[model samples]
Target: LCYFQQGSQSHSVKHYWYTSWPDHKTPDSAQPLLQLMLDVEEDRVESPGRGPVIVHCSAGIGRTGCFIATAIGCQQLKEEGVVDALSIVCQLRVDR
Candidate 1:
């Protein structure tokens, strides 16, 4: 994942990036995607922004949907009282 941050008055510009290999056949080659997410979160907290990332895949919907849903779940957990990622994901899927 890669995000381009257009700086706001409160925060500086930053590039938050992460990569993952989903091919199960090559598990050894699969790097830690969560670690990358953590780094991106740290960067984002250090520097907030307005612009969202341009996310896509070979077939963009499924991959993008999952990614965005997960982010929303985490955000909701922080902002709201949500505790279950799976339940949030279910609601998202139903709405979609």
Candidate 2:
């Protein structure tokens, strides 16, 4: 984890690196990744005033998209008892 001031002095940034993830494929096990996402969510909840939680991969699109979709899907499953992966992907695609 690294923390530094953003452009403005009033705000700062915290970046967490998961170097274990491969460049072209998903991890063999999802537990650690899921835990990381949960940790990030917990941090967000604890710091409601903080900026957006930025998650990304080296290439910026493929793995980034997968991580985002998984996070959203997990949230949906927890809240609504179902995971609409297709909808999440579609929404992400539209947003992207």
lDDT of each: 0.57, 0.84
Instruction: Name the lDDT value of residue 72 in candidate 1.
Output: 71
User: Each model's TM-score?
Assistant: 0.50, 0.85
| lDDT string, candidate 2, 1-96, tens digits | 455665765555667787657888668888878888888889889889787889778889987888899889989999999998899999999999
Top candidate (TM-score): 2
Best by lDDT: 2
| Tens-digit lDDT track of model 1 for 19-53 | 46442222243235446555656766765564554
Q: Candidate 2 — which residues are off by over 4 angstroms?
A: 1-8
